[model samples]
Target: MQNTRIILIGAGIGGLTAGLALQRRGFKVSVYEQAAQLGEVGAGLTLSPNATHALEAIGLGPDLAKLASRPARQAVLHYRTGDVLVDQERGDLPKKQYGADYYQIHRADLHDMLARAVQANDPTAIHLGHTFLGLTQNSDTVDVVFKNGARVTGDVVIGCDGIKSEVRAQLWGRVPPRFTGNIAWRGLVPMYRLPPGFKIEPASAAAVGHKHSMARYLIRNGTMLNYVAFAEKSGWETESWSVRSEVSELLEEFDDWHPSFKTFLAATPKDLCFKWAIHDRDPLPQWTKGRVSLLGDAAHPMLPFLGMGAATGIEDAVVLARAFQQAKSVAEALLRYENARRERTTFIQMASRAAQERLQGGKADGYTKKEHKNEEFLGLFSYNPATVAV
Candidate 1:
């Protein structure tokens, strides 16, 4: 089983982590990515203790600590008045409760770390520019064909190709992802560019309004601040993450927001503003079929309200490797992986949608910490995917 050849579609965070974890377990792994080069877009991601624990299990604890920022606290504030509605201590609390530290890191940094780790294990592990076209699996082996006319046969195939995965289309038939009637604008600002005395007290803050909200947190070791603003909208349906939006348009959209929001928006680089439509899919009955299975967004894409998208993907990678280690055969391993993950990921997917409504349904003035349904409050951080029974 240690010599089983695993072919992974998509070289995103989940795919890379899976490749690395399987390699560490002595499995011959190959990761195929659509892009010619390996890199992640400029954005910030929260690594809850659940995700941090998984990364630590894969030997990235030191590197993650170096590249990520640890927020001492997080708060939810009123969008118009800037009054704190919820304030939670985070510095040593997560470590004490979950046995791991919560971290905020640049997405690119984390992706690069995982990619490099996978490459270090086997220089030929990651195959670039191989767009996954489709696959054909029989009783014994799975054959994945790429657009570049390359066909590789492996013992097992895992699709970590993201929400718009071709692998998923071929497996489950094409089903359009449902747009959640929400649009988001994102930008990054250098901390030095902000006005003097500008502070993100509590380190991470989310300003909630009626049908709209904005969240910001420090990343890249406190040198950069990442912010994402959300608003309820309809009809506009382009979901590309690279779609640029005018800074003036963004300012006008949030014209009635608090003055501090405008200040942070003004500090953001005009060329760096981008917007994308949020989309998610209903939970599937299963993630595995024969020797092929799905992971990450490909398996269970969810709204970003809970900030657990990437964390769940990371968790999947760790548990998958563990499943392979314990199972007797490829079929057993795939079944174990899906059975272990389906219930949890499904719960998170549904809860994230509920959170979006709770946070943005009504006016922010009435919001309170007691009513918060965030990741920590939901007991999501307590899951150590690395040690969970798979």
Candidate 2:
């Protein structure tokens, strides 16, 4: 961890968070993002207590409060009648139980905050428009080649690109992410656009119907209402995130739901409606091959039922950095990091799959007990990435 040059392949939340954590530990860090301009393409993200603890450890605690929404409670409701199924307080419970606060924030807001922090540490740390083509390594350094015919060398290379990662394809084979026949519609509506008496709770909430689910929450300090609706559909050929759909299509999907939720969807503009298919890959047997390793979606892409996709990636960043601090060499550090993370991430992935099945009206075996009702989230929420052994 002493002044070794580290190259991160993607500038996403995982990549940027790893850069800052490595920089703070006295490592020279450089982040390369494929995009010409950095941005996020989602409505909102749920930062549970585990992720909040990791961010605070990386010194983003105060800045997070200023940019995120701390929902007082979270609830699950019946899709037709609006009856509460599960309601749990979040304000002080997370702090008392997990030693951190749960947060909901616009994805872009969190991305920008991390980019600024990385810049504030070193202005030239992040490089834009640098697409990773391939890499070659000897005994000491890895030489990374970009699409523009430029090469850069570093002591270690970390791949945070995403599910369709070039690094993963180059190191392993071209394994495609499997689509689970689930399509989701997402949009954000301003608070002022809602009609009178259409009350949205000041908490992260989800309503479940037959083979469909709708989640609504606030972001940017309750000024924006972020909504995501999911249903089973077939024949979605496109895999890109920029796929646009009609607002009427969205309305038809949720027409039988509660009226309050329907009113909220009616306000969404046609141009603002976005849809994407849910895709994930099975957990890899290994994340590190020599000096290179995968992180975030590249390592373990899971369904969003538990909402820990980004949070688990954040955990990878912290634990990987800590492994570097405790180990004697870079390879040893990476091995230690993988040993610490693989089981936890794989469990979450499988649990997320089961939760998705249940939500889609599969078997209802383990969802009855109070403690096991939301048990998949407890292991994720209670983890502390900084102090966990590596």
Candidate 3:
């Protein structure tokens, strides 16, 4: 495996995890990112046991726990009118259960941790500001072309660039992102400073106003409350991150809500609120093309409802690196990766879509929050790349 030289695009969780896992598997890996700076603007993510197992396999479990919260207890949901819809328990993870704890973390904190691990484990790794534009590969080697007029050679290339992946373009002619007719509004507020006399739920770091199709969570030791509000809409010209949105306009969407929810909206600063039109893609016929393939959102872009987008990508990275270690050729590794992951990730993508629809007041057969339990994710959670066989 040490003879393998892998080129990974995008320095997100998936890419970094792939680097750590491959390096641990005796494969040489280098990560590239288009961002000039490592700053990521996003709220916390719930890393269910499946993702936790992948992170632990990469050797960052202990440190990640320190940087994240495990939630004192399970979450309770309401329909914004103060009617309880679901009350579930948390914390029954076994040693070999999912192979890790269901850790929750701020996106930036998690990325920084992975970046630090990538650099520390291998000093001369992770090239920032190197944009991936194109690539070409012969039978024995691949040449990755970048926007900076530089070229890097490797044995295999993994695209973790994201939903609007350049690698996907390089593989299947230009496939644009499809707007899923949903508009998302998100903001973070200080918990201690939320409006005075606000009667908020106690188990709430965040809460969901089901009537408005919104959800919330907390980060930074429960000091900051992460708020996510959504509604059905259509046709976004561009699906890029960080779209501009006015707070006044966003607040209008929830103006007539419950007093507590309105109070929560009132406390959000104008500048902190940003909005984007949500999107996702249909599963591709194949994730790999020759020596180049996709990972993370590049492979499967799911709604954030289940919060498994990044987690699934992390799992893909670990499994891919392990598959390469076990297979005799890069082609075999590529095939093995798709074989081991396609169905599972496709299920998640479908589940995420189902969850989004259900939350939007749409009903469908065989789709229930009961089936999308924290335990169901344990299938992907319990997978450990070090000892994984296929």
For every model in order, what is the number of clashing pairs?
0, 0, 2
> What digit string (tens of lDDT, one per residue) describes model 2 on residues 2-70?
877889999999999898888777677999999999899868998988899889989999988899888
lDDT, residue 83, candidate 2: 70
lDDT of 1 by residue, 94-132 (tens): 999999999999999999999999998889989999999
By summed lDDT, the worst window of 10 consecutive residues in model 1 runs over 357-366
Superposed by TM-score, candidate 1 places the C-alpha of residue 308 at a distance from the truth, in angstroms, of 0.5
Instruction: Quantify all predictions' global Cα lDDT against the true fold.
Output: 0.90, 0.85, 0.75
The reply for model 2, stretches above 4 Å from the true place, is: 362-372, 375-378
User: RMSD in angstroms, candidate 2?
Assistant: 1.9
- In model 1, which residue pairs have backbone atoms overlapping below 3 Å? none
TM-scores of all models? 0.98, 0.96, 0.90
TM-score of 3: 0.90
Candidate 1 Cα outliers beyond 4 Å, as residue runs: none
Residue pair clashes in candidate 3 = 50-381, 206-216
Overall local distance difference test of candidate 1? 0.90
- lDDT (Cα, 0-100) at 119 in candidate 1: 90
State residue 367's C-alpha deviation in candidate 2, in Å. 8.1
